[model samples]
Target: MDFVHRKLEPPDLQDCAPQGTKVTDTDPRMIYHGEMIPVGTPDVAQGLKDARRALRTNRFRPTGRRKSMIIDGCAGKTTLLLQIGRAYQGLLETERRPDSEWTPVVYINVPPRRESNLDWSLPFADFFGMDHTINIDKRTYRSTDMTEPVAHAMRESRTSLILIDGIDRIHDSELTTAFDYFDCLQDRLRVSVIYCGRGAIDIVNEGLHNRRRSDRPGASEQFRSSLPVMWIRPIPFQKGQEEGWRTVLQSYDDNLRLYNHQPGALLELDEELHERTRGYMDTLDQLICQTAQQAIEDETEAITKEALDDMRVGRNEPDDDWA
Candidate 1:
């Protein structure tokens, strides 16, 4: 999975068809809808810049302010993290020796909370493809605490960065142990960690505050002091942000595979798109991609305002005005 992930790149406009050209291939056109469109929004651009600097400064440092980053937002957090990861992996491929087994970056989602004692190292073990369980007998097996072995694997692989998504899903009670595991990884492995999720700042700050109160030394003082956070919010429709928002729409417009879409069709609906999606990037994507698919199904082969209006997949219900 790591190998496949490293090989995967964000979908490109060339993956489908040139603008104003017909996209008759059913599979490719449909596949484009599910692809994460890599619009170079300011937030994403800034994230890449920060991630590069963190990876560079944290290199070979044994301790002190590893410069970890937390990307916090209600939306686009995971997408931005994945984008950074892909870019990081691409750069690693060029520097790595052909014989090296190093997997410089590890990306994993925070696993769901468990009823029993959660082995916080499980996600890392899974990422490294290590067995986290030991066979006690022919028909019996026990879960092995893989904290040491997973760290060993990371050391062997020479992993420099770890990208963790879905930090918000961890229950408050589980934060200490999970973060303790992470703290250990950073301190022992000397790896820079980047985390992503909604409300991540409050969640992590509260965890650190609780740890401080309890006098646990696991949450490193460096992490508490030097962790930099970048918030990724939806582009607002207000003045001064109009160009950015329209540029995003222009990117989508430029990539649409619809046969009859005009060059500036989506750009013209920037305001209406914002109104429909309330500036949520994911919802805006859903509106355009789903409407494009609907157009293809109905043989229109082009997105129209009427088709967009018929789609009701926003995160919130439409207001009475839109309804």
Candidate 2:
């Protein structure tokens, strides 16, 4: 992902942005550094454009901002947030010098699996030297309450970019609690967030059970209007769209030798690979990365079509869904 993300350098290109319908390599804002089109399709380019613009303008908000995003190809939403935080942090460093005015872009990853009794609203407390001195008696400083710690962290670091990854992974029972935490932080903090992962279904509808009706019944517009939900597909190679995709994969092959021993070999099995992956970004990445390991184990220089066919057949055997 780092290799893919570095490409988003600056300049300013007309096309290729998530929204740009007609993209050219001209005046591109160095944004394409290391980053490959998750799914080399035209549909997602528009969403990418919107996301990039929002990030630049600090418009990714909750109630008024784009609250949700449906990212494709990548796994581990928390890790991706960390990466975005690092990128924004670097950008902040470049844009604002030490003496200049700028707040630290705090990256907070909340895993629903780790439901500690401690207050979750101000999770950054641990990151900003508040979680030290693990003492039952003196830990809860009146000044360092749930919200104060976050405010202090923001003031001390002087940042407005607050990234909170993983909103859908929480336990079913804690969904409302998590929303409360999210609502509190979003409403009180003066920062923007990149809420990654499967955004709530509400993101498409308006607010909560808020629904609407035109010719047909539909959810409220607030849900759809608030957060810009962009769905990223896996990089694909249509019947004739193989060259560009091959270039992208070969680059991957070159970087991960163990994975791409057959740098030029994937083209041969493109048919079968496409059939199984069906252009899903995450699954495709997993397939190729895994195949690279398989190649090393099988002592083969190239991934054979027979191997893929066998794997596909086995993958579809009875009870395959259980697997």
Best of the candidates, lDDT: 1
Task: Tell me how far the alpha carbon of residue 182 in candidate 1 is from the true structure, in angstroms, after superposition.
Answer: 1.3
How do the residues 53-102 of candidate 1 rate in per-residue lDDT, one tens digit apiece? 77777775656847678888757888778877777777777886633467
Clashing pairs in 1: none
lDDT of each: 0.73, 0.49
lDDT of 2 by residue, 65-117 (tens): 33434342234334344555655566666766644334466655664443432
TM-score of candidate 1 on Cα atoms, chains taken together: 0.83
Residue 119 local lDDT, model 2 = 49
Instruction: Assess every candidate by TM-score.
Output: 0.83, 0.60
- Candidate 2, 5: how far from true, in Å? 12
Scanning candidate 2 in windows of ten residues, the lowest lDDT window is 27-36
